[model samples]
Every structure is written in structure tokens, then in C-alpha cells.
Target: MSTLDALQAALAEEHATLWTYGVLGARTSQSASPALYDAVTAAYRRHRARRDQLRLLVRDAGGEPVAAAVAYELDGALVRPPQVQRAAVGLEAAGVETLLALVARSSGEVRDWALTEATWSAVWQLELGGAAQTWPGAPELD
Candidate 1:
């Protein structure tokens, strides 16, 4: 895929992650857990920032950035702590995949950015559970 294509895909993933984090924050806020609520809020902010950056990158590359979907279908209700954590894990997993694609097809600053994002996603995954891979954004071998 081209750099534009990778940027577009990363933008889409960021949009989805933004929406997913909204759900996570809402559900965790209900429990009155300050820590989880703060984490979700931070993640939401990060995704939003990344989304905007991606749009700029796409435009600089002479391509129109894709818009976010009207709504995203989540795995399930995030009423409980475990449910919210699982949602976060799922979002990070998706991010890792998107960033991996970007890393593979991008160069210079874009490649560095993708690698950083993937590393952050991996850290988030580890925080959510014991989910850590040798290569965070790499596809698993059969």
C-alpha cells in the first residue's frame, strides 16, 4: 500500500478508537473509579490528536482524509470494570494492526510515528492484561 493508503487506514483506526474510548470512559465513570476514568480520558485525547495529525498528513500528501463512521459496533456493554478493560484491549489491538501497516509502507517521520504509536498500543495492551507480544504490531504466524 502507498503512504496515503496507510495514513488513511491509521485515520480510520484513530476514529474508531476515539469512539471506543468514549464508551470506555462513560462506563468506567459510572463506577467512580478515578484511575480508570483518567486513563480513558487520556487515551481519548491521544486518539483525537492523532486523528487530526493524520488528516493533515493525508492532505499534505494530496489525498483527502476519510471521515469517521456514524457509529461503531462495540463488542458488548462496558458496564463493569472487566468489560471496560476488555474494550480498551480490543481498541489497542486494532491500533497495533493499523500502525503496523503504516510502519511497513511508510518512511522517514511517518514510519517513526507509526512505530511510536505501535509501541504505545503495546504498553496499553500490557496494562489492560498480560497481553504482550515480542512484536506488538506484527501479524502472528500460523
Candidate 2:
């Protein structure tokens, strides 16, 4: 795939992740679930920043960035803190896949940026209670 294509795919995943995080954040209570709320909020902010950066990257590459869907379907119920954490982990895991693709299709600064993003996703997954993986984005290795 072309770098632009990979970037767009990554952008799309970011969009979905941001949407899911937003929902997760809304369901969480600051006083009742401080840790989960903070985690979700942090992930949401990170993804939002990445989404904006991706838009700039796409535009600089002379391609239009893909728009986020009106809403994203949650992986499962997010009523409780554990459920929210699980969902956040799932989203980061999925995002790692796209970031890996971005790294593969890009080079130089873009590839470096993608590598950083993928590493952060893996760490974020662990923060959300996921097991650490030798190859975070490659589920086949897990």
C-alpha cells in the first residue's frame, strides 16, 4: 500500500478510537471511578491529537483526510469500569495494527512517527489492563 493509503487507514482507526473513548469517558464518573476516568480521558486526548496531526499529514501529502463516522459501534457493553478499560484496550490494540501498517508503508520521519505511536498504543493497552506483547501490533505473535 502507498504511504497515503496507510496514513488514511491509520487516521480512520484514530477516528473510531476517539469516538469510542469519548463514549467511554462520558460513561465514567470522575468521583466514582477516578483512575478509569483519567485513563479514558488521557487516551481520548492523545487520539484526538493524533487525529489532527493525521489530517495535516494527509493534507501535506496532497490527499484529503478521511472523516470520522457520525458514531462508532462499541465492541461490547461499557457500563462498568472494567468494561470501559477492556474496550479502551481493544481500541488501542486495533490501532496498533494500523500504526504498524503506517510504519511499513512509510519511511523517514513518517515511519519514525508511526513507530512512536505504535509503541504508545502498546503501552496504553497495558495501562488499560492488557498483557504486554513482544510484538504489540502483530496479534499473530500474541
Give the lDDT of residue 87 in candidate 1: 85
What ranges in model 2 sit over 4 Å off?
none
Best by TM-score: 2
Write down the lDDT of every candidate, Cα atoms only.
0.84, 0.89
TM-score versus the correct structure, for each prediction: 0.91, 0.96
Worst 10 residues of 2 by lDDT: 68-77
> Model 2 Cα displacement at 50 (Å)?
0.4
- lDDT by residue (1-142, candidate 2, tens digit) is 8999999999999988888888999999999999888889999999999999898888877899999899877776889988888888989999998999999999998899889989999899988889888888897985
